[model samples]
Target: MGEVKVVFQSVDEVMDYLKALEGYSGDLDLQCDHMIVDGKSLLGILSLGVNRLLNLQIYSDNYEELIKKIEFCCRG
Candidate 1:
């Protein structure tokens, strides 16, 4: 497993980030406070109340691709 720290400027950015990761072959989880939610789940992400910094854990075989994609999405 690998980790990356990201921050979303707005609710729309969070939603868009999740949307862009659609069809990714591995598991992704984002944590904030004490909450952990599925990165691929828009509803779960929205429920995360994400604003500002979020910590992400990428549990995937292709850690490089997952990190790259996540970084691209959350880059603002």
Candidate 2:
């Protein structure tokens, strides 16, 4: 498993992020505090609220390409 920190600034950003995540075949989850949601679900992502950094856990060994695609939202 791999992890990355990302922040969504708006609803549009969340939509875009989910679009980028569509290509991922492995299990992907977005977590904030105690809430965890499916990374690919638009509603799930939006439920976490925006403009705050969140933890993304990617459960796959070949996730480098997926990471690169979503790196635009990565927080440092």
Candidate 3:
């Protein structure tokens, strides 16, 4: 699994992030504290709240491309 911390600035950013995930075939998860949800689900992401650093667990080895595409939302 690949892990990276990210934060969404707005609903629109979340939508864009989801769109980026569509290209990946492997399972993905979003973790906030002890809670974990499917990264592909808008409701799951919304439930985690926006503008907060959340861990993105991409279940794939070839996730660099997706990461590059979502650089705008990554928590530096």
Candidate 3 per-residue C-alpha lDDT over 23-54 given as tens digits, one digit per residue, 9 for 90 to 100: 57888899999999998999999999998999
User: Which parts of model 3 are misplaced by more than 4 Å?
Assistant: none
Clashing residue pair totals per candidate (backbone < 3 A): 0, 0, 0
**Residues 1-76 of candidate 1: C-alpha lDDT, one tens digit per residue:** 8778787767788766877677877788888888988877878877777564677787876777766766754533
Which residue pairs does candidate 3 place in steric collision?
Answer: none
Which numbered prediction scores highest in lDDT against the true structure? 3
Find the candidate with the highest TM-score and give its number: 3
lDDT of 3 at 27: 89
lDDT of 2 by residue, 1-76 (tens): 8899999989988878878877568998999999999988888888899988899999999778888998888896
Consecutive 10-residue window with the lowest summed lDDT within model 3: 19-28
lDDT of 1 at 75: 35
Q: Candidate 1's error at 64, in angstroms?
A: 1.4
TM-score of 1: 0.77
Which segments of model 2 are wrong by more than 4 Å? none
